[model samples]
Target: MSDNQNLLAEQRRALILDEVRRRGGVRVNELTRKLNVSDMTVRRDLDALARQGVIEKVHGGAVPVVEASTHEPGFEAKSALELTAKEDIARAAAALVQPGSAIALSGGTTTFALAHHLVDVPELTVVTNSTRVADVFHTARQTAGAGGQRSGSPVVVLTGGVRTPSDSLVGPVADQAIRSLHFDVLFLGVHGISVEAGLSTPNIAEAETNRRFMRSARRVVVVADHTKWGTVGLSSFATLDAIDTLVTDSGLSEETRAEIAEHVPGLLVADRATSGSVPGNG
Candidate 1:
């Protein structure tokens, strides 16, 4: 196809996605007939939308991407999706923690996944804003339940502050508490990251609260899924250069990966290939 044709195809894909989201599931034959395009063209459009997480491919059609109805899922609900990717990213993030290190776990499903993997990492000090992350480790500490690295359990510290609907501690109190604590590493799991927008969240107060952790911590390691790329959110906490390392899945686009490597100096891109994560670790 010509460059112009490819560009037009891209435009068509966007329109198709908009239509699918507006009208719910869209059948392949119907879209092909309505748009006066071949079935292959319709299939290609669906494929591209799925890659961007804007839509889901079905047996013969495409459906609007079904996100967690509540972005803030309870423990059981959050555990259901992205379990493997989150675990793999968690292991890589945890390996950065030494036996006697002070670390911070931000609020998110991915960070909560990281909390479970950190169970056996002993002698480390964990300071987190997420009630769930703290509760997970504290419950293990009290119950003596095992399932982590089989080393030693980390010391748990939960900040006292106003809880958001997402069960995350944020606002002035949380920011102050985080600033007072000097951490060896702060693990942030956020909504989106762009070369321009940096690390962002959907809430303004939470974003501001996270900035305090970024300022106080010695190193900032961001853990996110591949889908976070190109996505936009409400508030940006840190620029790309501000983060020390980025640990994400290998599914990120080549263009986005190249952009990050160029814009963010000394940013360690850790995945199964470059990092110690087992292949298919997630």
Candidate 2:
């Protein structure tokens, strides 16, 4: 494109970004009409902004990027933010679990969602430091027994430790317990995910505990939603290269997905339409 064209594109992207930040999100068709541009042009602008890390592209629109390095939201607070996306990601992550495999689930809203899906997997062993995650299984077992049915398998092991604002168990007790055990896979959840900071959390103790979980697991699968793409947290526990697979919702932009695909071995974009994962990278 020419210099004038480039300048016009920049100006249009700025306006597009402003709308996204103002409304919390913007649809492509709406932007096309507002900006008097073609649908393809609006998409291009959104893609550029997404690549710049200033905005996140959804299925047909864009939303402001969240970038908090030190701030940590509580479990209840985070749970209400992305309900649909979390469920989609959880489904994709759960598909990776085998019937009798051992797995570790870290604490966070997304991982907590995954816990509910694992309740019916037979002969599975789950070790988790999050009391909330463990309780999911415990509650399932209780409900099954009440119905006079065996909810066997998926034996839950809750680690002892201090709890964070996100309801994750951390500190020395959790770390020691995780270090001695091994798992087939780990479905980790994080406060943030970024190219520079990787998978991170605001709690230092939780970061350490997550590292122990990573070390004990043979394969690492990060279960995160699209909104986490540009966010950074205070303590980074693992880098993108360490992840064996990443399962996220389809709200992630193609540009962002390609960029992330370069770092991880596999990327699975969970689509609610199909209720399955679309492989980003083979």
Best by TM-score: 2
Residues 1-282, model 1: lDDT tens digits: 875685466546755764675478899999888889999989988887787667889899988765542243344544554554576678777777787788889888889988887777768889998988888887787676455433566777788787876678999889888877898888998777887788777778888889998888898888886656655566777888887777775555455567677755434333443446532211
Q: Model 2 Cα displacement at 223 (Å)? A: 0.4
Model 1 spans with C-alpha error above 4 angstroms: 1-79, 145-152, 266-275, 278-282
Candidate 1 is scored at a TM of 0.70
Tens digit of per-residue lDDT, candidate 2, span 1-282: 875686567557756765675478999999989989999989888888787667898898988976666788888878876577798889889989999899999998999999999999999999998889988988888887667536455788999999889888899999999989999999999877878899988888888999999999999999987767766789998899999999987666667788898999999988766768899985
For every model shown, what is its TM-score relative to the native structure? 0.70, 0.79
TM-score of 2: 0.79
